[model samples]
Target: MTTLLALSDDFGSQLGKGIGAIALYAIVGLVLVLLGFYAIDWTTPGKLSDLVRTGKPNAVVVTSAGLISMAFIIVVAINNSDSDLTAGLITALVYGLVGIVVQVLAIRILEWATRIDIGTLIQSETYSPASLVVAAAHLALGLIIAVSIS
Candidate 1:
């Protein structure tokens, strides 16, 4: 138990160093998801804006795809390593979950900065900066994990 705690602490510190960059990466991924919705909205049957407004398939589809893709990529990246995959994968799962919380905070900041109520801009091509910030943080974390293990 002590060994496990020590290892986790060591790893967490390394990850914490790159938290900002990781958030940026997460935000980028979020933006991509939003963009997917934009494309689907234009090409699909119903109005994308309406679906997002109602929080229907639009929100579900976009968020799910982004998360699923992130999970797969993270898991694969971690698992393929010769080093500690469990630690890496678990760290990513936890870290990514926390980043969502970070994004919630980012949303408020973005609202203040841009004066564009994020709720209203849900389905549009224009995504708020919150998503970008979160993605940057994620990108940083992912790089750290990938490099640390390698």
Candidate 2:
């Protein structure tokens, strides 16, 4: 029937749109994560990727925490975004950037308040207590930013 054909077309179109949205969000999320990683790298002494490749536990822990925090912000941004695709993408992007900035600020605050150089701590070969504290600060600030977006 023509009605059935039309229904199928409509469904297919909607499916395509949904897939497109997913791809867009995925790309955006990846970019945000990379940005967060670079932000951490910039604040630290050596390259984060190089440290990670050398099997440094402190570097790995700090990097993992930063990435996870970024993911939390992106997830919340996507969840709370507008129903409209363009609007939603814009909202997510803005919130994600804001989350990154806030996270960096949080790290700085922790370093100042605790009088521990997080960058130097993360460069250590062995895991340190300062690494744990930095990781916790990153996660807590990320959650706070994500919740504020919602």
Candidate 3:
């Protein structure tokens, strides 16, 4: 009976620490995701949120893809970070932001390589297959960065 009580106490303590760490990581991840949204918005020609809200197909695709990429970064960071929650939180933030920056830069580089203005493409009200390409690029970049974090 005493042994069982001790085990239960240990489990409770561990659960508390786990919850605290999750909270800290979640807050950091949210801030980073918001930053990613603004960064992506800055890159496009028009207001991404406005376009997405208005049912612009291209904008919807781009915005959703950007969000998924940012989420991938955060998940990888949280999973692979060191045991220290404080340090892990910092690592997650850094990885998330860096991953976002790199993905944006990749888009710009693709623009130069293809001699196409991705921003202009995204801003158009008409649906463009290029949006799918951009979305794939974002995911590819996210995956590459996430693996590196591990």
Best by lDDT: 2
Give the per-residue lDDT digits (tens) of candidate 1, residues 42-147. 4333564675567653344444433443444344433443344345445554544443444334334544575644344445455455545434433444344334
Superposed on all Cα atoms, model 3 deviates from the true structure by an RMSD in Å of: 2.6
Query: How do the candidates rank by TM-score, highest first?
Result: 2, 3, 1
The lDDT ranking, best first, is 2, 3, 1
Record all residue pairs in model 3 with backbone atoms less than 3 Å apart, i.e. clashing.
none
Give the per-residue lDDT digits (tens) of candidate 3, residues 1-150.
355434664898899999998788889888988998898889777888988888888889978988898788779977877789888887888878888888778766765776667668766889999888888877877777778778
Q: Give residue 114's error in model 1 in angstroms.
A: 1.5
* Clashes per candidate, residues 3 or more apart or on different chains: 23, 0, 0
Q: Which of the predicted structures, 1 or 2, would earn the higher lDDT when compared with the native?
A: 2
Off by over 4 Å in 3: 1-6
Best by TM-score: 2
Off by over 4 Å in 2: 1-9
User: What is the TM-score of each predicted model, taking all chains together?
Assistant: 0.32, 0.89, 0.87
- Model 2 residue 115 CA deviation (Å) reads 1.3
Indicate the TM-score of model 2.
Answer: 0.89
